[model samples]
Target: MKHISIIVPEGQSNLGTVACIVGAYEIFTRANDYWKEKGKKQLLTVELAGVSKNTDFHEGLLTVKPHTHISAIGKTHLILIPSLAHDYQTAVEGNQLLLDWMVKQYKEGAEIASMCSGAFMLASAGLLDGKKCSTHWSAADTFRTLFPKVNLQPDKLITDEKGIYTNGGGYSFLNLVLYLVEKYYDRQTAIFCSKIFQIEIDRQSQSAFIIFTGQKQHGDEMVQQAQAYIESNLHEKISVEELSSRFAVGRRNFDRRFIKATGNTPVEYLQRVKMEAAKKAFETTRKTINEVMYEVGYSDVKAFREVFRKITGMSPLEYRGKYNKEAA
Candidate 1:
């Protein structure tokens, strides 16, 4: 049986912590039972491994007991990290031991999977360096600020590469778990579990659900002004040259500073600002696709659709249908 260690990192836990842990156990064990019922051997041995000997009582509430502490764990095939409560920085600091243990286990032939905010822990351990990762869209800015080396794909629902996996926000860890089920078990079992849980199978991107609130946390006054100008003039065709001249910064220097401060180039930032405006139009106004596109300063229909699809993973009408109740 393959060993799966569900990590219970020490912290004032999120409300979903227990549910995420138990839910994974339920799915994997049920999958094993299904395999045996189909006349095969049971496939997994699961355990909740804690960082310390103490039984954890998070938020002065739920009491979580561990099956074994990490020191006792000699071999584990997979390590599952559930979401930590509240602040990512604070939660990670308290779980330093767990992070070190995770890195060690990962080096010893274990694949690591972090659910939601738990990606912060894996990132803290340096396992996420130079790897693509997904996290809660709300925490994307903070995550980027903290771990700039790790490639943050905030628009994705899941990211799996080189044995490290991270998922987007909330209980969507179910989708990540289901994906792992397909890899370790089979597609048949994954589809069966999806049907049983009513999960949307193979959901790859979280972009449609993400509201593009522009990132301006970096301490660059000119870059901040540039961002503000882009947002303010979404209905106008704004150019990099215009922004650089207006801000009194050179073009090459402006591009470098803009990318460093905002993680997006001048043109990409403008496009995003326009797309965000278009999204708001679709979500609120009963405008036609072309009307919305025009409202966001796009004159060409093909250009508008292509950019919208690129940013949102859906076409204009499709986005409207998905999000706009009035459009429905």
Candidate 2:
């Protein structure tokens, strides 16, 4: 059987730890069972290591140990470094024994995967040198400063090069597992897995991959003004003409600069901002999706639902239903 070992460090976030377990169950047991019967051997084994405090409640359900030696690391086809503490400075000075074990495993041909800040651990292992990797955008600066040898592609939800895969921040961990399913099984199988998990699979192009999550900051005065204008007037109708006049820039210059600054045009950026706000309202308040949509500048329920789904990969109703049910 192909053994996939998920290695979670101590002091991991509760959310991240739960996400790892969900990935294991969804990819290995629920999804791999079908693939195994079809002539493939796949198994998932979770191994935990570290001296930090065990803040992950879900880890109690798994048979994880305090230390994972080289012998235990042997025989796994894939090794996942789950998301770790947000302190990038501490990650730069991570555990040496774990780093050495990872090196040994990589040398023995184990595919390495990292979710979110887990890239910090992989980079510390020196395995990501000269290879394109990604992490949550908030950690992009810290990652770059700490691991200059690694070619960090900040925009990807996940980047798969050779046997190494790294994911961007948030729940893109789910997307990473889905990518693995497609690789091992087929596109149809991946689609089935997505449906089972209620995950929306948005097949992305290269340009689209570069477009989301890793946009460069625009320090231009006009661009910043435009952004401020949009945020201050999110509930109001924001027009390009208003933005151009507010920023004292021509319409053509404003359009080009807006895209250059935030990676999306003014309208797209405004809609994304609105959707983000609407998401927060739906989760934190009892307001309906339609009410939140209108509050965020969207007057049309159909268009509001479409935009939320397009950006977040989930409709406002779906997001609310998922999170609200859990919150309750």
TM-score of each: 0.95, 0.58
Q: What does the lDDT come to for candidate 1?
A: 0.87
Q: Model 2, residue 245: what's the lDDT?
A: 86
Model 2 ranges off by over 4 Å: 12-14, 36-70, 92-94, 202-328
Per-residue lDDT of 1-328 in model 1, one digit per residue for the tens?
Answer: 7999998778757667787888888888888878788898878888999976654555556777788988998889999999877677888889888888888888989999999888988998889999999998888888889999999999899999999999998879999999999988899999988998888899998887777777888899989988888887777877799999998889999999999898788888888889988999888989999888877888999999999999999998888888889886
Q: Which tens-of-lDDT digit does each residue in 102-221 have in candidate 2? A: 778788888988887889988887889989998877777567767778887665677888799998876777778788778756887788888888776854312122223323354677
Pairs that collide in candidate 2 are none
lDDT (0 to 1) per candidate: 0.87, 0.69
TM-score of 1: 0.95
Worst 10 residues of 2 by lDDT: 205-214
Top lDDT: which candidate number? 1
Model 2 score (lDDT)? 0.69
